[model samples]
Target: MLHDAKLPKTLWGECIRHAVWLKNRTLTKVLQGKTPYEVAFKRKPNLANVPDWGAKVFVSKKSKSKLLVHARIGRWVGFNDDVEDFEVSKGHRIYWEDSRSVTVERTVVFRKDEGKVRGFIEVEEEGVEVGIEGEGSVNNPNNPANAHISNSPTSPETPRSESLEPV
Candidate 1:
Protein backbone atom coordinates (compact mmCIF):
# COMPACT_ATOMS: atom_id res chain seq x y z
CA MET A 1 0.00 0.00 0.00
CA LEU A 2 1.16 3.55 -0.58
CA HIS A 3 0.29 4.26 3.03
CA ASP A 4 0.55 1.39 5.50
CA ALA A 5 4.13 0.63 4.53
CA LYS A 6 4.90 4.30 5.19
CA LEU A 7 5.91 4.43 1.56
CA PRO A 8 6.25 8.10 0.68
CA LYS A 9 4.52 7.34 -2.58
CA THR A 10 6.83 6.20 -5.35
CA LEU A 11 8.00 8.68 -7.93
CA TRP A 12 4.19 8.68 -8.00
CA GLY A 13 2.89 6.13 -5.50
CA GLU A 14 4.60 3.77 -7.91
CA CYS A 15 4.02 0.34 -6.37
CA ILE A 16 0.25 0.08 -5.99
CA ARG A 17 -0.55 2.22 -9.00
CA HIS A 18 1.79 0.40 -11.35
CA ALA A 19 0.61 -3.03 -10.21
CA VAL A 20 -3.04 -2.01 -10.58
CA TRP A 21 -2.58 -0.76 -14.14
CA LEU A 22 -1.12 -4.05 -15.26
CA LYS A 23 -3.86 -5.98 -13.47
CA ASN A 24 -6.63 -3.86 -14.99
CA ARG A 25 -5.21 -4.15 -18.50
CA THR A 26 -4.78 -7.88 -18.18
CA LEU A 27 -8.36 -8.20 -16.90
CA THR A 28 -9.65 -6.06 -19.74
CA LYS A 29 -7.83 -8.25 -22.23
CA VAL A 30 -9.08 -11.53 -20.75
CA LEU A 31 -12.75 -10.65 -20.32
CA GLN A 32 -13.24 -9.18 -23.78
CA GLY A 33 -16.59 -10.90 -24.25
CA LYS A 34 -20.29 -10.55 -23.62
CA THR A 35 -20.76 -10.04 -19.88
CA PRO A 36 -23.61 -11.38 -17.78
CA TYR A 37 -25.04 -7.90 -17.58
CA GLU A 38 -25.19 -7.89 -21.36
CA VAL A 39 -26.69 -11.37 -21.59
CA ALA A 40 -29.25 -10.47 -18.96
CA PHE A 41 -29.98 -7.21 -20.70
CA LYS A 42 -29.71 -8.87 -24.11
CA ARG A 43 -27.25 -6.50 -25.77
CA LYS A 44 -23.53 -6.25 -26.38
CA PRO A 45 -23.37 -3.89 -23.38
CA ASN A 46 -20.97 -1.01 -23.02
CA LEU A 47 -18.34 -1.15 -20.25
CA ALA A 48 -18.51 2.58 -19.62
CA ASN A 49 -20.64 1.74 -16.56
CA VAL A 50 -17.93 -0.05 -14.58
CA PRO A 51 -15.53 1.82 -12.30
CA ASP A 52 -11.81 1.27 -11.72
CA TRP A 53 -10.82 -2.12 -10.35
CA GLY A 54 -10.23 -1.01 -6.74
CA ALA A 55 -11.76 2.40 -6.21
CA LYS A 56 -13.52 2.97 -2.92
CA VAL A 57 -17.31 2.80 -2.82
CA PHE A 58 -19.71 3.88 -0.13
CA VAL A 59 -23.11 2.28 0.29
CA SER A 60 -25.61 4.57 1.97
CA LYS A 61 -27.90 3.84 4.91
CA LYS A 62 -30.90 5.65 6.36
CA SER A 63 -29.04 6.32 9.58
CA LYS A 64 -28.02 9.95 9.89
CA SER A 65 -24.79 8.89 11.54
CA LYS A 66 -21.88 8.76 9.13
CA LEU A 67 -21.28 5.03 9.10
CA LEU A 68 -20.40 4.59 5.45
CA VAL A 69 -20.44 1.10 3.99
CA HIS A 70 -16.91 1.12 2.61
CA ALA A 71 -15.93 -1.23 -0.21
CA ARG A 72 -14.15 -1.48 -3.56
CA ILE A 73 -15.80 -1.68 -6.96
CA GLY A 74 -13.62 -4.23 -8.69
CA ARG A 75 -14.80 -5.20 -12.15
CA TRP A 76 -12.83 -6.19 -15.20
CA VAL A 77 -12.67 -3.11 -17.43
CA GLY A 78 -14.24 -4.91 -20.38
CA PHE A 79 -17.10 -7.43 -20.24
CA ASN A 80 -17.61 -10.60 -18.28
CA ASP A 81 -20.88 -12.30 -17.26
CA ASP A 82 -19.53 -14.85 -14.85
CA VAL A 83 -18.68 -12.44 -12.05
CA GLU A 84 -21.70 -11.52 -9.98
CA ASP A 85 -20.20 -9.57 -7.12
CA PHE A 86 -19.29 -5.94 -7.53
CA GLU A 87 -16.25 -5.53 -5.29
CA VAL A 88 -17.01 -2.69 -2.93
CA SER A 89 -14.27 -0.41 -1.61
CA LYS A 90 -13.78 2.35 0.90
CA GLY A 91 -10.38 3.00 -0.65
CA HIS A 92 -9.23 4.93 -3.69
CA ARG A 93 -9.34 6.93 -6.88
CA ILE A 94 -10.17 5.21 -10.18
CA TYR A 95 -8.50 5.73 -13.55
CA TRP A 96 -8.54 4.63 -17.16
CA GLU A 97 -5.11 3.87 -18.57
CA ASP A 98 -6.43 3.25 -22.09
CA SER A 99 -8.86 6.18 -21.99
CA ARG A 100 -6.45 8.95 -21.24
CA SER A 101 -6.46 10.34 -17.70
CA VAL A 102 -10.24 10.48 -17.29
CA THR A 103 -10.98 9.31 -13.73
CA VAL A 104 -13.71 8.80 -11.12
CA GLU A 105 -14.31 7.75 -7.53
CA ARG A 106 -17.35 5.97 -6.11
CA THR A 107 -18.90 8.36 -3.66
CA VAL A 108 -22.34 6.88 -3.09
CA VAL A 109 -24.63 4.04 -4.12
CA PHE A 110 -28.13 5.17 -5.06
CA ARG A 111 -29.54 1.68 -5.20
CA LYS A 112 -28.14 -0.48 -2.47
CA ASP A 113 -30.21 -3.66 -2.70
CA GLU A 114 -31.64 -3.37 -6.19
CA GLY A 115 -29.97 -6.59 -7.22
CA LYS A 116 -29.99 -7.73 -10.88
CA VAL A 117 -33.34 -6.02 -11.39
CA ARG A 118 -31.57 -2.71 -11.22
CA GLY A 119 -29.45 -2.49 -14.37
CA PHE A 120 -26.66 0.05 -14.31
CA ILE A 121 -23.89 1.68 -12.32
CA GLU A 122 -23.26 5.34 -11.62
CA VAL A 123 -20.64 7.30 -9.67
CA GLU A 124 -19.55 10.80 -8.87
CA GLU A 125 -16.44 12.51 -10.22
CA GLU A 126 -14.41 13.80 -7.33
CA GLY A 127 -10.62 13.94 -6.98
CA VAL A 128 -9.09 12.66 -10.21
CA GLU A 129 -5.61 11.15 -9.78
CA VAL A 130 -3.75 11.92 -12.94
CA GLY A 131 -0.79 9.77 -13.91
CA ILE A 132 1.90 12.32 -14.75
CA GLU A 133 4.02 9.77 -16.52
CA GLY A 134 3.57 9.52 -20.27
CA GLU A 135 3.02 6.19 -22.04
CA GLY A 136 6.68 5.32 -21.52
CA SER A 137 9.87 6.52 -19.91
CA VAL A 138 11.21 9.76 -21.38
CA ASN A 139 14.54 9.32 -19.64
CA ASN A 140 15.54 6.53 -22.03
CA PRO A 141 17.71 8.05 -24.78
CA ASN A 142 16.02 5.73 -27.26
CA ASN A 143 12.55 6.75 -26.16
CA PRO A 144 10.73 7.50 -29.41
CA ALA A 145 8.85 10.46 -27.99
CA ASN A 146 12.18 12.16 -27.52
CA ALA A 147 13.59 11.08 -30.89
CA HIS A 148 14.85 13.78 -33.22
CA ILE A 149 13.15 14.57 -36.48
CA SER A 150 14.73 12.59 -39.26
CA ASN A 151 14.91 13.25 -42.99
CA SER A 152 13.92 9.76 -44.13
CA PRO A 153 11.27 8.75 -41.59
CA THR A 154 8.39 6.65 -42.86
CA SER A 155 4.74 7.80 -43.02
CA PRO A 156 3.76 11.44 -43.16
CA GLU A 157 5.67 12.52 -40.07
CA THR A 158 9.37 11.88 -40.00
CA PRO A 159 10.78 11.05 -36.58
CA ARG A 160 7.34 11.84 -35.27
CA SER A 161 6.28 9.99 -32.14
CA GLU A 162 3.63 7.27 -32.14
CA SER A 163 0.96 9.74 -31.11
CA LEU A 164 1.61 11.55 -34.39
CA GLU A 165 2.65 8.38 -36.25
CA PRO A 166 -1.03 7.46 -36.63
CA VAL A 167 -2.61 4.04 -36.99
Candidate 2:
Protein backbone atom coordinates (compact mmCIF):
# COMPACT_ATOMS: atom_id res chain seq x y z
CA MET A 1 0.00 0.00 0.00
CA LEU A 2 2.87 2.36 0.78
CA HIS A 3 4.53 1.70 -2.60
CA ASP A 4 1.22 2.07 -4.45
CA ALA A 5 0.60 5.38 -2.70
CA LYS A 6 4.09 6.64 -3.78
CA LEU A 7 4.88 7.43 -0.15
CA PRO A 8 8.34 7.37 1.43
CA LYS A 9 9.63 4.26 3.20
CA THR A 10 9.58 6.16 6.47
CA LEU A 11 5.76 5.92 6.41
CA TRP A 12 5.83 2.13 6.33
CA GLY A 13 4.69 1.90 9.94
CA GLU A 14 1.68 4.08 9.32
CA CYS A 15 0.78 2.10 6.20
CA ILE A 16 1.04 -1.18 8.08
CA ARG A 17 -1.21 0.09 10.82
CA HIS A 18 -3.74 1.29 8.25
CA ALA A 19 -3.57 -2.04 6.43
CA VAL A 20 -4.33 -3.93 9.62
CA TRP A 21 -7.26 -1.70 10.35
CA LEU A 22 -8.67 -2.42 6.90
CA LYS A 23 -7.95 -6.12 7.21
CA ASN A 24 -9.95 -6.33 10.41
CA ARG A 25 -12.92 -4.86 8.63
CA THR A 26 -12.67 -7.10 5.56
CA LEU A 27 -14.49 -10.40 5.11
CA THR A 28 -12.46 -13.58 5.06
CA LYS A 29 -13.21 -17.24 4.27
CA VAL A 30 -11.38 -18.22 7.43
CA LEU A 31 -13.97 -16.34 9.43
CA GLN A 32 -16.86 -17.91 7.50
CA GLY A 33 -17.27 -14.82 5.39
CA LYS A 34 -17.58 -12.61 8.49
CA THR A 35 -15.25 -9.67 9.04
CA PRO A 36 -12.92 -9.86 12.00
CA TYR A 37 -14.38 -6.61 13.21
CA GLU A 38 -17.86 -8.06 13.08
CA VAL A 39 -16.77 -11.05 15.07
CA ALA A 40 -15.20 -8.88 17.73
CA PHE A 41 -17.53 -5.91 17.81
CA LYS A 42 -20.75 -7.77 16.91
CA ARG A 43 -21.66 -5.13 14.37
CA LYS A 44 -20.82 -4.24 10.80
CA PRO A 45 -18.08 -1.69 10.45
CA ASN A 46 -18.99 1.72 9.10
CA LEU A 47 -16.67 2.12 6.13
CA ALA A 48 -18.18 5.34 4.84
CA ASN A 49 -15.34 7.47 6.22
CA VAL A 50 -12.49 5.40 4.81
CA PRO A 51 -10.46 7.21 2.17
CA ASP A 52 -7.91 6.00 -0.33
CA TRP A 53 -4.52 5.41 1.20
CA GLY A 54 -2.39 8.52 0.86
CA ALA A 55 -5.09 10.42 -0.95
CA LYS A 56 -4.71 14.18 -0.76
CA VAL A 57 -7.05 15.65 1.86
CA PHE A 58 -8.02 19.27 2.33
CA VAL A 59 -7.58 19.94 6.04
CA SER A 60 -9.03 23.17 7.31
CA LYS A 61 -6.39 25.47 8.81
CA LYS A 62 -6.71 28.01 11.60
CA SER A 63 -5.42 31.50 10.93
CA LYS A 64 -6.57 35.03 11.68
CA SER A 65 -5.13 36.37 8.40
CA LYS A 66 -7.93 36.84 5.90
CA LEU A 67 -5.60 36.37 2.91
CA LEU A 68 -4.20 33.05 4.08
CA VAL A 69 -5.55 29.85 2.60
CA HIS A 70 -8.16 28.26 4.85
CA ALA A 71 -7.09 24.70 4.10
CA ARG A 72 -3.87 22.70 3.90
CA ILE A 73 -3.20 19.59 1.83
CA GLY A 74 -2.38 16.42 3.70
CA ARG A 75 -2.16 12.68 3.06
CA TRP A 76 -4.82 10.36 4.51
CA VAL A 77 -2.78 7.92 6.56
CA GLY A 78 -4.86 5.94 9.07
CA PHE A 79 -7.66 6.03 11.65
CA ASN A 80 -7.52 6.74 15.37
CA ASP A 81 -9.73 3.94 16.72
CA ASP A 82 -9.62 5.29 20.26
CA VAL A 83 -10.98 8.67 19.30
CA GLU A 84 -12.84 7.58 16.15
CA ASP A 85 -10.88 10.21 14.23
CA PHE A 86 -9.26 10.31 10.83
CA GLU A 87 -5.48 10.54 10.67
CA VAL A 88 -3.77 12.80 8.18
CA SER A 89 -0.07 13.32 7.52
CA LYS A 90 1.47 16.74 6.95
CA GLY A 91 5.23 16.64 6.48
CA HIS A 92 6.47 14.24 9.20
CA ARG A 93 3.63 14.93 11.62
CA ILE A 94 0.25 13.27 11.96
CA TYR A 95 -3.02 15.01 12.82
CA TRP A 96 -6.32 13.54 13.88
CA GLU A 97 -9.89 14.83 13.55
CA ASP A 98 -13.07 13.36 14.90
CA SER A 99 -15.08 11.52 12.26
CA ARG A 100 -18.09 13.75 12.81
CA SER A 101 -15.90 16.85 12.52
CA VAL A 102 -14.65 15.91 9.04
CA THR A 103 -16.91 16.96 6.21
CA VAL A 104 -17.09 14.71 3.17
CA GLU A 105 -17.34 16.86 0.08
CA ARG A 106 -19.32 15.61 -2.88
CA THR A 107 -16.88 16.61 -5.60
CA VAL A 108 -13.38 15.12 -5.81
CA VAL A 109 -10.79 16.17 -8.37
CA PHE A 110 -8.02 13.76 -9.25
CA ARG A 111 -4.42 14.81 -9.78
CA LYS A 112 -2.96 15.38 -13.21
CA ASP A 113 -0.54 12.86 -14.61
CA GLU A 114 1.83 13.65 -17.49
CA GLY A 115 0.21 17.07 -17.87
CA LYS A 116 -3.26 15.54 -18.32
CA VAL A 117 -6.15 15.59 -15.88
CA ARG A 118 -6.78 12.05 -14.66
CA GLY A 119 -10.53 12.58 -14.05
CA PHE A 120 -12.93 13.48 -11.25
CA ILE A 121 -15.96 12.28 -9.29
CA GLU A 122 -18.97 14.47 -8.64
CA VAL A 123 -22.12 13.82 -6.62
CA GLU A 124 -25.06 16.19 -6.66
CA GLU A 125 -27.01 17.25 -3.60
CA GLU A 126 -30.28 15.85 -4.85
CA GLY A 127 -30.27 12.59 -6.78
CA VAL A 128 -26.71 11.32 -7.30
CA GLU A 129 -25.26 10.87 -10.75
CA VAL A 130 -21.71 9.61 -10.57
CA GLY A 131 -19.62 9.85 -13.67
CA ILE A 132 -16.07 9.94 -14.96
CA GLU A 133 -14.85 12.43 -17.52
CA GLY A 134 -15.11 10.03 -20.45
CA GLU A 135 -17.78 7.74 -18.98
CA GLY A 136 -21.48 8.36 -18.76
CA SER A 137 -23.22 9.08 -15.46
CA VAL A 138 -24.79 6.34 -13.34
CA ASN A 139 -28.01 7.34 -11.67
CA ASN A 140 -28.77 3.97 -10.14
CA PRO A 141 -26.93 3.06 -6.98
CA ASN A 142 -27.04 -0.66 -7.86
CA ASN A 143 -25.32 -0.08 -11.19
CA PRO A 144 -21.78 -1.33 -11.58
CA ALA A 145 -20.61 2.13 -12.59
CA ASN A 146 -21.53 3.45 -9.14
CA ALA A 147 -19.90 0.64 -7.23
CA HIS A 148 -16.75 2.62 -6.52
CA ILE A 149 -18.50 5.01 -4.16
CA SER A 150 -21.00 4.49 -1.36
CA ASN A 151 -23.45 6.84 0.32
CA SER A 152 -22.56 7.85 3.84
CA PRO A 153 -25.08 8.07 6.64
CA THR A 154 -26.29 11.61 7.22
CA SER A 155 -26.96 13.29 10.55
CA PRO A 156 -29.39 16.02 11.53
CA GLU A 157 -26.54 17.99 13.12
CA THR A 158 -24.82 20.48 10.87
CA PRO A 159 -21.22 19.81 9.90
CA ARG A 160 -18.89 22.05 11.90
CA SER A 161 -15.69 23.46 10.39
CA GLU A 162 -12.77 23.17 12.76
CA SER A 163 -9.07 23.83 12.23
CA LEU A 164 -6.59 21.00 12.10
CA GLU A 165 -4.72 22.71 14.88
CA PRO A 166 -1.51 20.89 15.68
CA VAL A 167 -0.93 19.79 19.28
Candidate 3:
Protein backbone atom coordinates (compact mmCIF):
# COMPACT_ATOMS: atom_id res chain seq x y z
CA MET A 1 0.00 0.00 0.00
CA LEU A 2 2.87 2.37 0.83
CA HIS A 3 4.69 1.76 -2.42
CA ASP A 4 1.50 2.04 -4.46
CA ALA A 5 0.67 5.35 -2.77
CA LYS A 6 4.24 6.58 -3.32
CA LEU A 7 4.72 7.25 0.41
CA PRO A 8 8.17 7.54 1.95
CA LYS A 9 9.93 4.53 3.52
CA THR A 10 10.03 6.35 6.85
CA LEU A 11 6.28 5.82 7.10
CA TRP A 12 6.68 2.02 6.92
CA GLY A 13 5.50 1.62 10.51
CA GLU A 14 2.30 3.56 9.86
CA CYS A 15 1.68 1.59 6.64
CA ILE A 16 2.15 -1.73 8.45
CA ARG A 17 -0.21 -0.65 11.20
CA HIS A 18 -2.84 0.42 8.70
CA ALA A 19 -2.42 -2.89 6.82
CA VAL A 20 -2.96 -4.83 10.03
CA TRP A 21 -6.06 -2.79 10.80
CA LEU A 22 -7.49 -3.53 7.36
CA LYS A 23 -6.51 -7.20 7.56
CA ASN A 24 -8.37 -7.63 10.81
CA ARG A 25 -11.49 -6.16 9.26
CA THR A 26 -11.21 -8.26 6.07
CA LEU A 27 -12.47 -11.81 5.66
CA THR A 28 -9.97 -14.66 5.60
CA LYS A 29 -10.22 -18.23 4.30
CA VAL A 30 -9.09 -19.56 7.65
CA LEU A 31 -11.97 -17.75 9.34
CA GLN A 32 -14.59 -19.12 6.93
CA GLY A 33 -15.49 -15.62 5.55
CA LYS A 34 -15.86 -13.98 8.96
CA THR A 35 -13.41 -11.18 9.67
CA PRO A 36 -11.10 -11.35 12.69
CA TYR A 37 -12.60 -8.13 13.97
CA GLU A 38 -16.12 -9.55 13.71
CA VAL A 39 -15.06 -12.67 15.59
CA ALA A 40 -13.41 -10.71 18.36
CA PHE A 41 -15.81 -7.75 18.64
CA LYS A 42 -18.98 -9.76 17.94
CA ARG A 43 -19.99 -7.19 15.28
CA LYS A 44 -19.05 -6.13 11.78
CA PRO A 45 -16.39 -3.46 11.59
CA ASN A 46 -17.39 -0.13 10.06
CA LEU A 47 -15.34 0.85 7.02
CA ALA A 48 -17.33 3.98 6.15
CA ASN A 49 -14.72 6.40 7.47
CA VAL A 50 -11.67 4.76 5.92
CA PRO A 51 -9.53 7.13 3.80
CA ASP A 52 -7.19 6.21 0.98
CA TRP A 53 -3.60 5.58 2.00
CA GLY A 54 -1.27 8.54 1.37
CA ALA A 55 -4.11 10.67 0.01
CA LYS A 56 -3.73 14.38 0.55
CA VAL A 57 -5.88 15.62 3.44
CA PHE A 58 -6.69 19.23 4.28
CA VAL A 59 -7.18 19.24 8.03
CA SER A 60 -8.71 22.20 9.86
CA LYS A 61 -6.07 24.06 11.76
CA LYS A 62 -6.83 25.10 15.32
CA SER A 63 -6.13 28.60 16.70
CA LYS A 64 -5.48 30.18 13.35
CA SER A 65 -5.76 33.86 12.51
CA LYS A 66 -8.85 35.09 10.66
CA LEU A 67 -6.87 35.79 7.45
CA LEU A 68 -4.70 32.65 7.59
CA VAL A 69 -5.43 29.43 5.77
CA HIS A 70 -8.02 27.43 7.65
CA ALA A 71 -6.52 24.05 6.85
CA ARG A 72 -3.16 22.31 6.96
CA ILE A 73 -2.20 19.82 4.24
CA GLY A 74 -1.27 16.32 5.40
CA ARG A 75 -1.04 12.71 4.30
CA TRP A 76 -3.60 10.15 5.38
CA VAL A 77 -1.61 7.61 7.35
CA GLY A 78 -3.99 5.46 9.38
CA PHE A 79 -6.68 5.43 12.08
CA ASN A 80 -6.52 6.03 15.80
CA ASP A 81 -7.22 2.94 17.91
CA ASP A 82 -8.52 4.76 21.01
CA VAL A 83 -11.05 6.91 19.20
CA GLU A 84 -12.86 7.12 15.85
CA ASP A 85 -10.32 9.57 14.43
CA PHE A 86 -7.99 9.73 11.46
CA GLU A 87 -4.22 9.75 11.87
CA VAL A 88 -2.64 12.21 9.46
CA SER A 89 1.05 12.89 8.90
CA LYS A 90 2.12 16.53 8.75
CA GLY A 91 5.86 16.96 8.51
CA HIS A 92 7.38 15.16 11.56
CA ARG A 93 4.20 15.18 13.65
CA ILE A 94 1.05 13.07 13.51
CA TYR A 95 -2.31 14.76 14.03
CA TRP A 96 -5.66 13.13 14.68
CA GLU A 97 -9.16 14.64 14.56
CA ASP A 98 -12.51 13.35 15.73
CA SER A 99 -14.28 11.73 12.82
CA ARG A 100 -17.55 13.48 13.59
CA SER A 101 -16.07 16.92 14.06
CA VAL A 102 -15.75 17.98 10.43
CA THR A 103 -17.29 17.60 6.98
CA VAL A 104 -15.22 16.09 4.14
CA GLU A 105 -15.16 16.85 0.44
CA ARG A 106 -13.30 14.29 -1.64
CA THR A 107 -12.19 14.80 -5.23
CA VAL A 108 -10.09 12.81 -7.69
CA VAL A 109 -7.55 14.70 -9.85
CA PHE A 110 -6.44 12.92 -12.98
CA ARG A 111 -2.88 13.41 -14.16
CA LYS A 112 -1.82 14.03 -17.76
CA ASP A 113 -0.57 10.45 -17.89
CA GLU A 114 -3.45 8.03 -18.28
CA GLY A 115 -4.21 5.65 -15.39
CA LYS A 116 -2.43 7.95 -12.91
CA VAL A 117 -4.84 9.32 -10.30
CA ARG A 118 -4.56 11.28 -7.09
CA GLY A 119 -7.11 11.90 -4.37
CA PHE A 120 -7.68 15.18 -2.57
CA ILE A 121 -9.64 15.43 0.66
CA GLU A 122 -10.71 18.71 2.17
CA VAL A 123 -12.34 19.42 5.49
CA GLU A 124 -14.82 22.26 5.44
CA GLU A 125 -17.26 23.89 7.82
CA GLU A 126 -20.60 22.18 7.85
CA GLY A 127 -23.65 24.15 6.57
CA VAL A 128 -21.42 26.84 5.02
CA GLU A 129 -22.59 28.32 1.72
CA VAL A 130 -20.08 28.51 -1.15
CA GLY A 131 -20.93 30.33 -4.36
CA ILE A 132 -19.57 29.71 -7.83
CA GLU A 133 -18.61 32.54 -10.20
CA GLY A 134 -21.92 32.40 -12.05
CA GLU A 135 -23.34 28.94 -11.30
CA GLY A 136 -24.90 29.95 -7.95
CA SER A 137 -24.43 28.17 -4.62
CA VAL A 138 -22.41 24.95 -4.69
CA ASN A 139 -22.84 23.76 -1.11
CA ASN A 140 -25.72 23.66 1.40
CA PRO A 141 -27.75 20.92 -0.21
CA ASN A 142 -30.40 21.16 2.50
CA ASN A 143 -31.55 24.46 1.04
CA PRO A 144 -31.80 23.55 -2.64
CA ALA A 145 -34.55 26.10 -3.27
CA ASN A 146 -32.05 28.86 -2.57
CA ALA A 147 -29.54 27.44 -5.06
CA HIS A 148 -30.64 29.75 -7.85
CA ILE A 149 -30.89 32.82 -5.61
CA SER A 150 -27.71 34.77 -6.35
CA ASN A 151 -26.37 38.28 -5.74
CA SER A 152 -27.35 39.43 -9.24
CA PRO A 153 -30.18 41.97 -9.48
CA THR A 154 -32.19 39.69 -11.78
CA SER A 155 -32.15 36.89 -9.20
CA PRO A 156 -34.99 36.95 -6.70
CA GLU A 157 -34.19 37.38 -3.02
CA THR A 158 -34.67 34.40 -0.70
CA PRO A 159 -36.78 35.01 2.43
CA ARG A 160 -35.28 34.15 5.81
CA SER A 161 -37.04 31.17 7.40
CA GLU A 162 -35.36 31.51 10.78
CA SER A 163 -34.85 34.43 13.14
CA LEU A 164 -31.54 35.48 14.74
CA GLU A 165 -33.16 37.09 17.80
CA PRO A 166 -33.64 35.12 21.03
CA VAL A 167 -37.19 33.81 21.29
Highest lDDT: give the candidate number.
Answer: 2
The whole-model lDDT of each prediction reads 0.38, 0.60, 0.57
Which segments of candidate 3 are over 4 A away from where they belong?
82-167
- The parts of candidate 2 lying over 4 Å away from their true place are 82-167
Per-residue lDDT tens digits for candidate 3, residues 23-138, read 99999999899999889878898887566776656656655579887666555666556333332321222323333122232322222222223332233546443454242334
- The alpha-carbon deviation from the true structure for residue 74 of candidate 1, after best TM-score superposition, in angstroms, is 11
Q: Higher-TM-score candidate among 2 and 3?
A: 2
Candidates in order, TM-scores: namely: 0.22, 0.50, 0.49
**Which pairs clash in model 2?**
none
Pairs that clash in candidate 1: 10-13, 36-81, 57-89, 71-88, 71-89, 71-90, 72-87, 72-88, 72-89
Worst 10 residues of 3 by lDDT: 107-116
Q: Is candidate 1 or candidate 2 better by TM-score?
A: 2
**Using alpha carbons, what is the TM-score of model 1?**
0.22
Tens-digit lDDT track of model 2 for 12-130: 77788778988999999999999998998788988874567767666566779999987765566665553333333212223233331222332233232212223434344655444
